[model samples]
Target chain A: NAGVTQTPKFRILKIGQSMTLQCTQDMNHNYMYWYRQDPGMGLKLIYYSVGAGITDKGEVPNGYNVSRSTTEDFPLRLELAAPSQTSVYFCASSYEDRGLGGYTFGSGTRLTVV
Target chain B: AQSVTQLDSQVPVFEEAPVELRCNYSSSVSVYLFWYVQYPNQGLQLLLKYLSGSTLVKGINGFEAEFNKSQTSFHLRKPSVHISDTAEYFCAVSDAGGGSYIPTFGRGTSLIVHP
Candidate 1:
């Protein structure tokens, strides 16, 4: 099913620079999420979408934005990159809520902000 | 709001020895708990999860977890460890509310299996 896929396996951005992390899933999941992983920290959700055109902020939503235009695509936008934002990003999708099943995660995008 | 805590930051064990990673959570509403493993340079993968039905849930890689509602804990355990089992393990919780599906993850516990 190809599960979940993310583009730009790695990236480096300068202060104030902006970029978008692309994510797509072929499982036709109704839920999609963006998370960041720091050196010693666990994955923190940045944003999520319950369905196309419906999005919401997550625990660590500051400094980031997201849009879900289609059921298969959910992109995360970093408006002004900062060194603190440097981390590995993972995208995931699930068929239903957490009760239904576990999420399928993408390989991940490693980003470094200089 | 829901939150998770992984008691250990790092656990070192010899190969073929038993291991356990402790986890605790706090939430006012019902929650679904999960454990995910991340290998070096790899994405996080689901190790096990506890929803309803059973307090004991078995997951991939010969790992299992017991959900203790009284203690608000979901600890992952393996009968025997291997070098391949070396990875960072994260405990997570998600609200069971119909509208919220985002999960809250613990800081993470690094499991180092030494030969």
Candidate 2:
């Protein structure tokens, strides 16, 4: 099974442009997360969802919105792209009840804002 | 508030040498600790975690970490290093007392292994 999948492996957006980063998981996990990693910096949480129809803001949720409509899908939206938002975005999923196994991450989407 | 600190920003070592990446965390309540590795242009992968049980946790690729409650540290160690082990490592912490599932990650430490 495809553990986790993220689309648009690479993208370049002009200032003020907008785009959506799509994520999907086949594990039927209850927890999904969005994170962005900048150069020399750790991954910062952008958004998270405990389950379908539930979403919450994370540490760096500014300029981003997320929705969890189905168990398999959770997408992140950027209203207005900025240079500061240029980084590698990753989508992850985990089983909340089973805390032993850790999160599974997608390949990642490299976004560059000019 | 929960926070994780990876003291070293970069570590350079020769192949076949032992290496240690130091990590320290601060939290008022009980918490879960984790170490994740990210290869160049790749997503983060779980290296190991300290949820409960033994203080020492072993992970894939011959890596391990020991959780010290008193020092509030979870330092990753490897007896021998390979050039392939070069990557960025992150230390993260999350509260285990409640429904707090969000983890706070440290800035990250870059491990560079030279042959």
Candidate 3:
């Protein structure tokens, strides 16, 4: 199983430009999340989905949007990129809530906004 | 609401020495605690988690953590360190009684191991 996969391992975008960060999981997990990591900032949740067709805003959702159309995919969209949005993005999946089962994470996507 | 605090921003240690990384959390309801390790340019990997059962939980790479509900702490420890153990560690808490299971992560602690 591929676990969780995030695409475009590296990307550079100009200010005001937009792009999507892709995420997919083969575990058939019910929960999926998108997080951004910055120096000394750990990881901040950007968006999450409990299951297909369901999505919710997270702690730092200001510059992102997510949709869970299929059980395997949840992609994050940046309407307008900013320098502050430059960070490493990660996708994680869990089988249940409360971390009854630990989370599986993807390598990460390093985004640089200039 | 839930929050996690990693007491130290960085911890430097010599190889073969014992080390501890402190973590404290605050939450009104029951909470599930977890420790994750992140290597350079990679995602966080679960070192261990406290869902229920024993207060002490052991994880991969010879790492372990003990959950103290009274102190609201879950400190990670290792008897001996290796240079390869140098990485960023994070503490997270998920409120089990809340409607959402989204966890709150600490700012992270960088563990630098010296040879």
Candidate 4:
């Protein structure tokens, strides 16, 4: 079963270019999240959506946007990419549970800005 | 906002040896703690988590962690480790009673299991 799927596994964009990192999950999970992982910065939340038609900015949401118009898709958009935004982006989904928050993550999309 | 801190940046251990990776968080309210392991070029996988009851929680791959409320710590311990365990381990925390369930992750601890 394809739990979570992310597209454009690797991409190199010129400065000021914009693109969208697509993410879709077949588990029908209510919670979806986008996180960026840098070398030493660990995983920082970029955006999150609890359900369709709801989204919120996270710790490092600058220069990024997200929309959850449907339950299966939550695509992250990078507007005006910059060198500082070069990092691996991960998409995850989880069932609503207060105890033990285990997320089903997709293989991340590696993006680099030149 | 909650902050998680992994005491050690790296822990080098020989195969078949016991290992412990410490994790601590600073939060004013109740929080849920978790440990995740990330292999090379792979997404992080849940190693274990601490919810409410049972101070000691066991997880997959023979790993266990204890939630110490007074100390605000949830350190992961393994009685023995294998070479396959060489990866980066992360500690995360989320509010237990808050509305937003966003998690804050630590800097991560690299566990180098030498054969």
lDDT of every predicted structure (CA atoms): 0.91, 0.91, 0.92, 0.91
lDDT tens readout by residue for model 1, B9-115: 99999999999999999875678899999898877888888888899999999999999988999999999999999999999998877646678889999999999
Q: After superposition, how far is residue B19 of candidate 1 from its true place, in Å?
A: 0.1
User: What are the candidates' C-alpha RMSDs?
Assistant: 1.6, 1.4, 1.1, 1.3
TM-score of each: 0.94, 0.96, 0.97, 0.96
Which candidate do you rate higher for TM-score, 2 or 3? 3
Residue A90, model 2, lDDT? 96
Model 1 spans with C-alpha error above 4 angstroms: B97-99
> On TM-score, who's better, 1 or 3?
3
Candidate 3 vs candidate 4, DockQ winner: 3
Question: RMSD in Å for candidate 3, one decimal?
Answer: 1.1
Query: Where in model 3 is the C-alpha error above 4 Å?
Result: none
Tell me how many residue pairs clash in candidate 4.
Answer: 0
The superposed Cα distance between candidate 4 and the true structure at residue B30, in angstroms, equals 2.1
Q: What is the lDDT of residue A38 in candidate 4?
A: 93
Expressed as tens digits, the lDDT of each residue in A41-74 for candidate 1 is: 8888888888999998888999999999899999
Error of 4 at A11 (Å): 1.0
Candidate 4, residue B95: Cα displacement in angstroms equals 1.3
- B-chain TM-score, candidate 1: 0.95
lDDT of 2 by residue, B1-115 (tens): 6878899999999999999999999875778999999898778899999998999999999999999998999999999999999999999888888756678889999999999
